[model samples]
Target: MYRVLPGFHQIQQPNGSYFTVPDRYINLFPFKVDKPFVVQAFDRVMERYVVIKKVVLPDSFLDRQPWKRAQRELFCMLYIQDENVVNMYSAFTPAATREEMTEFYIVREHMQGTMQNLSPPTFGEHRTVKSIFFDICRGVQYLHAMNISHRDLKPENILMTRDGDVKLCDFGHSNMEDPNANTPYIVQRYYRAPEIICETMDNNRTSVDIWSLGCILAELLTGRVLLPGRDHVDQFILMVRFLGNADQLFYSVMNERARNFLNTYREFLENCQPPTDIHSHFPDEVFQGGLSGQPEECRMARDLLFRMLVINPDDRIDILMVLSHPYLAEIWDRNMNPDDIPQPQPPEALRNFFRFQNIFAPETLRDEIFNDLREFGERFNIFTGSKN
Candidate 1:
């Protein structure tokens, strides 16, 4: 066993490289007690700063399964290779054998900070805001194209580099778009999509991600959460108030529980006023000084927001469409030309592992993750290209 130190600890990886991390955690969220211990670390081999996420393994099978998320996150990091997405260097257990492992560690590129620390975008920095939003869209688009959905897409999950580039991180809540998986409470409250709120998300998983992007973009423009709902009930009510009552098509897809909830607030629904346009939230003056110094930019931004924040998932704009929108035209041309982007094939082994069987048991997931780690070590390396 590695010696525990008060000041710092050196964690040796399977590949002989090691990371030196401080004893104290760099991040600890009060709301999520089960969150992994995140600390800043120095890579001895790479000679660069890195973030090490330490996940404690539960001793008993009866306990909650944190490894499930860790397994999915590890798979996603390995599968995706994008500049806009955070790069995970490696994942491994400290113990020599899988049965002896007590902790799982994921080593990734160190980011300066999350978007939460940044100041709100002002009118003078409209183009900069657009660029940031463009980066986010590119990340989301790449994930969607790879058949993954980052269910949580709030500012906190968006990390900023020292050079001001934004990259998506925290894949605990991310997964492949499975229509059978109906998780209404997957996303954070403020950025949650209406379809997710109403439990009407049939096969439209990626669109919920687009809704979150819309909320994030709105926050970037105004410096506040677009929909600050106190609770689930209030969140749905806020959506109704902002986008007006759901259409017949929206109601048609909603399950029995959602229908019952709507009936509970039938009186309030009847009394709610007509929904306001996106312009009312972000007026022309907001985009006067920046955004090409034209009012048309405001219209385009609003138009994009309107389409993105659509109440109906079917009517919502896809990631590709969002990338193609006029507001992000310049960034799209410069960085994200369709021909230049490379499409990666999703791992068939992982896909079959998730789809073929009931892998909910902790033991099953643990074994799968062990196999994945072994395969990853053999086939892939950061310094060199894939062996296969």
Candidate 2:
């Protein structure tokens, strides 16, 4: 069920006494994709556009009290309110005064559009693409310091503002990178990392995001998906053709199911003449004239891409190294030094691998979300100008 109460802010009374202030949000439209409904709501009080993503709790799941499921995702989204990340304005379950509520709503600071909207011919300039990449790295760096993985990173989910500010949104597949738990199908098909597709446990969580970023950066620069695979098998073929095999060790470590896939594609691998050079695939024109075109900056950016688009997860560049890459100096912020940002204590690991299997009851989740905002306040001094 979806509901939008206009001017949720408190209001004044006709009498000398005052009523409630105006509500912070007002619903503009109801959007549906499949069964769940996502609403475009306005923050009447704040004067900002906000998106309310609905998380449905079916009767069967509710029987198990799956609050932890929703909690895990909300926790990840609300965990840190960083500028590079889409801010969670609030989270709550809808309950009428007379009846109990059934589902959850995650309210986010609505963005103008997504990075997908900026694909080439429209905004394919190199500097424009560079800005997009810088923000992505900044967001992932924060998640990595907390020992978390985005699990899913793609253009559609990366929101961008009118001023070129980017916000990484959608932590629906985020996790703490537990070695023990087998990762479900994580990233979207095109952006899926080789390690993730192979189901190799040897790779760490942060590397997965880096790999996805590599794919994203390539698309932003080239105005096309680097590897647009029709399926897992095709994806493997595409990667092998361009990046070459990651390592034989990646094959040995693969789980039985993944190994079987390689066996099926063995003939194709044998016949395929892997290209010796990848430079031709990313032409000089694509990097130079289209992007900033500075010879030194282009050289450094190409080098960074080489490190990120590695076939092996172990070979993938470290997330911190990306921030320091010389190519990014134009957009880099000296105050936001990667060395100065210490790791944060991640939220307590969700006891149940709920995966949004179950989550907080309305009041329970709301209280926790409010606490997140409060924690953000204490940590950043946004409210009292006091930092921890």
Which candidate leads the pack in lDDT?
1
By TM-score, who's the top model here? Answer: 1
Q: Which residue pairs in model 1 clash with each other? A: none
lDDT of each: 0.70, 0.64
C-alpha RMSD between model 1 and the true structure: 5.8
- The residue ranges of model 1 lying beyond 4 angstroms of the native Cα positions read 1-36, 58-66, 119-123, 201-204, 273-277, 285-294, 334-361, 375-388
lDDT of candidate 1 at residue 134, scale 0 to 100: 82
TM-score of each: 0.81, 0.76
Error of 1 at 296 (Å): 1.8
- Local accuracy of candidate 1 as per-residue lDDT tens digits, 262-381: 888888876765446566766765443455366676777889888898887888878877877777777655535444554545556556544543457888777767777767756654
Residues 1-388 of candidate 2 have per-residue lDDT tens digits of: 3343343333222232222212554554543333135556666545667776766544443343334445566766655657788877666443332134454557777777778774445443456767878888888877777666887899878888777889898776766666665664867889998877778774446788888998888776666788999987788789887766555777887888888869887766666654565455565567523464455555666777878888777777777778776667667544335464444443444323333333445455534544544454456433122111
